[model samples]
Target: MDAELLQRFNPEEFYRHFLADGLRPDGRQLRQSRAAELRKGALGSACGSASLRLGRSSVLAGVRAELATEEALGRVEVSVELPALAGALFREKHRALGLMSFLSNTLTELLNSPAVFDPAQLAVQKEVCWMLNVHILCLNYDGNAFDLCLLAAIAALEDTRLPALMAESGEVPRLAVAAPGSELVAEARQLALLARPLPTTFAQMPGGQWVLDPCAAEESLGASVSLCLVEGRWLVFHQGGGADAGRFLEELMPLARGEMSKLTRLLEN
Candidate 1:
């Protein structure tokens, strides 16, 4: 039988054959991760934006700032869109909605956490402030969407610039976006992030082997775990299948830390 026919009919068998030889169909070792590419300020209209590609998975994130009342001050709202064209799984409406909700809520919580971003920075005064609306769109889905989304969000937020606040006595303050060549352009300030969080994702193959940065085919075959590191603390998310969670952490912590370090360096540069 040809390779394509075997893969189409018996993906498990095909994957097992490759694993037996200590390789993946993509020619990567079990412990290897895909290369990531990132670009900031990809959107001209938004306050900030970033485009990130992790292996074949691509995501774009944009941030827009709006004036808000005291009650909504310093709030960040996140929304994720996963269209059918991105992947076969998303072709089902329910599955796409479920995953979209999960990713949106998870990212909103992470971005709003004080350990990552300080809400106080958004405060313009006592009753006026800025609210950030962040939107993430997945252009391709090859697996590891969570990691790609989070990193894209961080990059967009870092690229964001808040306009100058204009206040008048006994009146609500407004934001001022300086025109080109205006001196007030210098007054606009970049958003300050308190911590840099990065995620390393691993897929647990059926045979009890964990593969780092699994592609779409490998992901469909097993459970997955994502470990995010922020300021010396870890946030873990696991889905489907069961294993010795503690043991998994023990074995993967070093690799995860190393991956986070590399990502941190990327952001810094």
Candidate 2:
């Protein structure tokens, strides 16, 4: 194709035609997501951390175990931040901030729920519980920020360990501080979550093709489908743009299940 002809070519229309036949311009099937990568224990200062990537996009998550001021156990605080560098690479600071806010609120709600993780596990007994601070930073943004953030956070939780805690009855049975990673500490490591709460997102292209794990380009022109699998059931089916989306779950379920399988293998390895 010459430059003049290529200049007039229509990529969107091409995508539509290709999608009609159950294919994408990138040669992936309709239900396939981009290859995903997970790196656990990336932050040395954090109690536990993990980095995750889907194609060019990446996120890093960390867990910090802090002494609780209140008597409540299993209380979690989550924060999502996009540094100036990340904003410059992606979009304007204000726009980036808005995007982060949306993702952050959704993640906060999900993680706060018992279906995602049991907060009760953070407690030692009835006396007190550890306050878990979960932070997620955007290293890169391709398309699925929610999915990547959740995965990274979960991986970070898996990697997290606490210093041996001691309680002595002086003023009010205050927590004792033992050195981190000390053999004298009785409970340093917490077990990972047994339920693998893998979430995946899909998007519908202009041609009404439901594409799983859309990249930056596809995401620009598609409606989104985000969901998490909970004990063999789907929770939080957030689909946007069209009313017909209700029936789309028939296709989305298999794709979400496949993503769950992929994430499970990543964690296991």
Candidate 3:
């Protein structure tokens, strides 16, 4: 179907289908997320890698560790893009660029959060720190890209294995970089994962209906609310245009919080 025609389609029928069956069109309960699958160490060259599948959606994450000698203690740059193959309809350059901008801004905030990661650990010398680069690729974006991206990034970092570091006795603050094939002798440190807890997205229909983790079709028809809460320290909540956005977020907070708590355990291993 063409983009215009797809956008013209109404979601009342789909909502009715869910109401009649007490389940979503995709056969999920109101609070249930689609099935999720996680595979770690998928990229051989990266320090850490993982592929994630959430129902029809797919995302991959890779982590690279580089030496940072610059004076800036902490610097993180996140870029997200959708390839033409990922979404046949979104092949335009402008669309891809806009998506990258959005994802980068969202991720940079987490990196800047002081509670998430320690900048001092990256220091190799008196003022040198390691630069950790994390890349998240969206293979297929059925919906809920933010939540999926965050999850994939965390999973990949958890799987990351770093190399050994040794200080050199030569002049200045010198050190030998570890070869990839060398034995694992470096002390591993945790990646800066923002204390941000779980991410739950809600799609609010015209009336009072609120759907969690809406598919692409539902998302096109209604407004969305994305909430990320980290236990007690932080909450990053965003709402997009759709009717009754105020009520939806207020009522959905507790429910979304519960789901996030459950999802956090999946990242543990």
Candidate 4:
């Protein structure tokens, strides 16, 4: 949906639709999604990857596995970028850089937090280890971009399989990843395992109506929150738009759980 359509939608009408059908204007059954598709190994050179299209919004996530530096070992470096060509509005170079910085900081915090991946498992040789460079490209915008990116990253990482690490010399401690036969498999072996903690997002529209995965129109109507759930708990990251956010959070709990269940099924299949 277009952002302009969202800006023009009447709050009263939107709420009326929700009340009538127990769903949103898009008729997604409150917890239902419009349809999502994921592509793995989309980028030929990347070690691991996936791309997801949630209706009109597109997210491409790539995993670059590398030996961790002393400071970054046992941690994941997740970054996001919306290049100028990716969106018509983001034509300026500075705008794209600024967005990348913002996204990197936000995701870095999540990856480092205890609620997400377990950083301790990344250790290799007691110092040098493995790190995940998760890069997200937002090729299109239609609201719910943050949630889609997070979901895509998790799914891509889940599908990723790192090869076993072997020492080349006892003195030098040189290591080799992946298996001997395939270069592709050998590259994958050098990395450590990745741990993923799931997160699901919900949006609260106007008139106290809550919806899971609100499209562009519903997102712009009022204040909304992105609730990041991990292991049956909530780790809220952002809630914007001068809305009565607390009440909305309480109301959307059940809806978020239901949507997450469906999402898990989609990825598993």
Candidate 5:
């Protein structure tokens, strides 16, 4: 084929052509989504932890709790780390700094918001309160970091257990956490988490065909949608793809709902 003809058959065009017939480069059907595997309590040293793998991307989250040392609006803290071992993309001096900063800051802000996770569950009025610190590490970069990180963090929090505070009879009356695995600790409530905002990513091909949960190669190739769903409600709709937003709402909205349902079930199990 001539250069002009080859250019005419670009990857996006070919992908659209195949997608119209329910085919993909990775052999998935047009509406098929990648499976996610979550292993709760994976980190022994941490208070609570979970390791989640979405396709080839891996995210690990650990939840630690301690007495609040500084004044803050909420009881939860979130930090995202993309180490060099995760991918060479993370090792770039300037680029990685910017990307990590954006991810961490955005998630931290959203998590502290009242709608995502309930902070009241972590607080015991004015008497006693514990601050939860969530640390997430990207073990591998295969795209879908936003959704996978949220998945791991939520699962870890759900798996977390806090030791009940015990009153110590001393001159100062210091409070101490009950020993782990003790009867008092066993009675403490598990972290209370609300039904969450599930993230769904879609890649738009040249002919307006949409692919959900795009892989790494698909992500860098073009623009896409990063949407979040909670009980079928659209919490956030981020446009990162070249596709028409109107057409996407008209054609792919139902597909995204199906994806949200699937992800919700995955998190439940």
Candidate 6:
């Protein structure tokens, strides 16, 4: 039987053959993650933007700033969109919506955390402030969407710059769009980030063996556990599939930390 046919017809068995030899079909060892590339400021129209490619999966994140009332100050809104063209699974509206909600909520929580970002930074004054809207779009879906999305979001935020504020007597401060060759352009400030939380995902195979950064085929076979190291703490999110979460963490923390360090260096460059 052809390899692709075998993978499609009996994925579990196909993976078992590879696992027995301590290898994955993608030519990676069990603990190896796919090569990743991150490019910041990918979109000129947005306040800030980034494009990321992890193996075959691709994601883009853009940050836009809008004026907001005191009640909405320091509020960051996140939305994730998975078009049908991204993958077959997204063609099912309900499934796509569910995933989108999960990703959006997760990102919102992380970005809003004081440990990750300071609400005070968004404050322009007492009555009004800046609200950041982060929009994430999945360009391709080979698997591991959570990791890709989070990385892209963080990179975009790091690339963001808050426009200069112009104040008139007795009026609320408003964003100033600097004209070309204007001095106001130099007044823009880079968005300050308190921390960067990088995520590493592992998928449990049929025999309870965990593989890091599973592709689409491997993901369909088992549950996945995603670990984000945030300021010396681990944030764990597990997708259902009967895997042992505790053991997965205990055995994988060292590897996850190393991956996080590499990601940090990537963002710095």
Q: Write the per-residue lDDT of candidate 3 for residues 1-269, one digit (tens) a residue.
A: 54344345745654664556667767788667887888889999988888988889898889888766666684555566678777764688787777667776787666556776556656655566667788888898788877788788778766766556765556685555555664443555655455644678877655557778877766666677777765454354555664554564577877776776567766764
Clash pairs, candidate 3, are 122-129, 122-130, 123-128, 123-129, 124-128, 164-186, 197-229, 197-230
Q: How many residue pairs clash per model? A: 0, 1, 8, 7, 3, 0
Instruction: By lDDT, rank the candidates, best first.
Output: 6, 1, 2, 5, 3, 4
Lowest-sum lDDT 10-residue window in model 4:
185-194
Q: Write the per-residue lDDT of candidate 5 for residues 57-147, one digit (tens) a residue.
A: 9999999987653443346788888888888777876876776776677667666666777776766436457788999999999886778
Local distance difference test scores for all models: 0.86, 0.75, 0.70, 0.67, 0.73, 0.88
TM-score for predicted model 4 compared with the true structure:
0.76
Leading candidate by TM-score? 6
Colliding pairs, model 6:
none
Expressed as tens digits, the lDDT of each residue in 1-269 for candidate 1 is 89999999888888999999889999999999889899999999999999999889999999999877756458788999999989988999999999999999999999899899999888776676788999999999999988999999999999999876443335653446555555441256789889987888999876788899989899888889888888888898889988787766688777898787679877766
The true-versus-predicted C-alpha distance at residue 50 of model 3, in Å, is 1.9
For model 5, the run of ten residues with the poorest summed lDDT: 179-188
Better candidate by TM-score, 1 or 3: 1
lDDT assessment of candidate 4: 0.67
Better lDDT candidate (3, 5): 5
Top model number, lDDT? 6
Local accuracy of candidate 2 as per-residue lDDT tens digits, 93-212? 777777678777777776777766777777766656788888999876777777888888888888888767665558675666665554442376664675767888887788776778
Cα misplacement distance, residue 34 of candidate 4 (Å): 2.0
| Clash pairs detected, candidate 4 | 163-189, 177-186, 177-189, 177-190, 178-185, 178-186, 178-189
lDDT of 5 at 56: 88
Across 95-149, the per-residue lDDT of candidate 4 in tens digits comes to: 6677578668877777677666666666666667777788888888777767778
Q: Relative to the unseen true structure, what is the C-alpha lDDT of residue 207 in candidate 2, on a scale of 0 to 100?
A: 73
Writing each residue's lDDT as its tens digit, candidate 6 over 182-236 gives 5552257899789898899989999898889999888889788899989999898
Error of 5 at 210 (Å): 1.7
